[model samples]
Target: MLKIGPIFNYLQDMADKDASRMEMSIPQLMEKGYTWVLHRYHLSMIRYPKLDEALSIRTWHSPYKNLYSLRAFEMTTSFGEVLAKATTSWIIINYSTKRPMRLDRHVTSQYYKEIIPFEFDFSSLSPLERIDLEDIYPVRIRDLDINNHVNNAVYVEWAAETVPTNILQSMRPSEIDVIFKEQLTYGEKAVVQTQKEKTASNVFDHVILRESDAREITRIRTSWKNMPL
Candidate 1:
């Protein structure tokens, strides 16, 4: 139901917005060349949109400072139903030192002028459980990236491939929150561990690990919805 390209575009646009806010607070300092670098990001999508649906996004900086800046985003349908929510963690880094810098007073005050409040208890997110999932297809040489490691984005591609064929064709993964725990060296085989939880609905948790050592490489949580197949 979600359009992959557009969702990616939205993420980029939001990044730009966050950057612009940062720039406004310290034009001179920012102009002198210090900037922020993302350290972690997490996205949780509940439902995907049907074709031609208009949506709105709202974001605000949370309370964390310096070593971590918490930004939360919510996407909603035209009728105001919430579609997805995501959180990103960032750090201020000295370009020259390549080390993280404390968020000076000015930057913090500027962004959190109107902080939005939300309750998120990550402790209950459910541990990395296991389930029976389809085997990962072969990883080709081309699948490797410039770092001599598997590309982070490739995890999304692989997870999408493992969805049921019928589900794969009809719905797009509206939201995915991925955590990169480690890197995969060249030719490292990956095994996917998955779990499905249901109360009123089904939620999925998947972990990708090195096939040989069984070390976790990354975890991806994807949410799906129904549309005409």
Candidate 2:
């Protein structure tokens, strides 16, 4: 079955392809001294495909607003059976200053589209009130992506590492919502903290912090379902 980490990579890849189609790919934006960064994601899975299962993925962007842009993705089987869907928010930042820039300042309105496959509230994710489990993972060179920072998908893996073994073995993530707060790079270590939601045993909240200064870098919430027999 597909795992959250790979699924995230697929979503990001599709988004990149769409951006390339608009002449806004990462390399293209970097040449203009700007790079798009993912801010938030809300992904729900209807089913995870088996290994070697053929799949089709589609992604499109919505109208840009102020400093942010919206993108949505859908994954399906050969017959168009919906397997997963996601909505993401992103912002373009000046590569040199590392600060967000107005979308219109760089990207023209011509690239914006009104087609939205789905909607997800991008409200701030709440902080974890308590930690039920914690673990530490050292950043490795292999974890870095093209931007030279820890890949967004690595944060999801770090958070999952803190989940209880029983839950990891018995349940599959049905939905995952994440907010990226800061960038992590090689030679750093992440402190992952996880807490099971009191109201829903199958739901978990996670926070990933930089071990050097205890700075929170990411927040995630995952809803899980029992594995099918």
Candidate 3:
């Protein structure tokens, strides 16, 4: 099975590592009372590789819009086959106040080295109606990132766990969209809910809400295709 965990992690890890090269790392931003938060995710999975395979990632960004920036990524194997491609939305906000802030010239100049065209269109992103599956997820220590909140990628892994086994064995996710609603912290539990429209067997709708106060954590829409043996 192609575990959906590493791709997003690699995407994020590369972001931070690359940012540090330009002196715009997370710690640097945090010192200014600001930190970047992932707001949205869009991934297109073309194929999965086996062990002993290595992949390369190429990422670029669009100009920041107010407080938001759009980034594009493509992951290719050593053979130059595109395995996955993605686009994500990020926002920098004041940590103490939790308020969105505009990107200043100093921050933007850090990583504007190379400008690459966006490989995916943003128009396809549309709101997905909430689906209520009956499962509850508890956040643990391992789920937290450096920010002490649940990492954005953890939401994708949690959603994958809720997927039915029969579907998991036979199908693979071709497309995934994750829209973050709120942040999850330790000691909180999330209510896992999902819905799949009968007319669209390949598409599944997912939502995760904090059980403590019924606050939404995230909403994900995934499209699947038959796995090749």
Candidate 4:
């Protein structure tokens, strides 16, 4: 029996959701001369299901080109309400050269047999207005990854915490994208500021900064839907 919390913990949830499906394993793909790297992802938790809830996930490749892979997923609870849904963009890299490559026909056929298009229009709530709040979190030793910089997951964790719980519980995240502009080394301080979009109901924009030096490290835009957007 797969327990929910441990495997579905903050960071692992994003990864395990992808690993449980798919015809070919990541390692297998690497051996076959391709590597998959996550470009961006959006996660929304609408009522985190109980521990014993029997859940099922289905993933399909919507389409792809040399630069990116468009994959979609549907997650349902045992009682059958869609718990989580997301589309991920992945890039196939040449392991030796570390450059992106065009997706192969054989690989596309293996993952997706038919193409169905779906767009939630989450962008309508993006690029929020400028209202400012200060968020400071100490960069812990554990936050440091092998690259000697703060891990990307930490940014998401901080942003999620800063978002109001009522808004988060009522709305699911329709889309989220972030760009890493700089690095935050261990023992360095980090700060975050979030603002809402004047044009949209639940759009939030955030900036992560290095508190010690006041250098911006990342920028994030998040959009939410009362129902699925």
Q: What do the candidate models score in CA lDDT, each in turn?
A: 0.63, 0.85, 0.78, 0.61
- For model 1, the superposed segments whose C-alpha errors exceed 4 Å read 24-47, 77-81, 92-101, 105-109, 112-114, 123-131, 134-154, 169-177, 182-202, 209-215, 223-229
How does residue 184 of candidate 4 score in lDDT? 82
Compute each candidate's TM-score over C-alphas.
Answer: 0.61, 0.94, 0.90, 0.61
The numbered model that scores best in TM-score is 2
Model 4 TM-score is 0.61
Show where candidate 2 strays beyond 4 Å: 108-110, 113-118
Q: Which runs in model 3 stand beyond 4 Å of their true positions?
A: 105-108, 117-132
Least well predicted 10-residue stretch by lDDT in candidate 4: 1-10
lDDT of 2 by residue, 73-168 (tens): 889999999999988899999888999998777775457553554556864668989989999999999999878889888888888777788888
What lDDT does model 2 reach?
0.85
In angstroms, the error of model 4 at 224 is 6.3
Tens digits of lDDT, candidate 3, 119-195: 55542434345554558878899999877889888888787767787887788788898888689999999887877
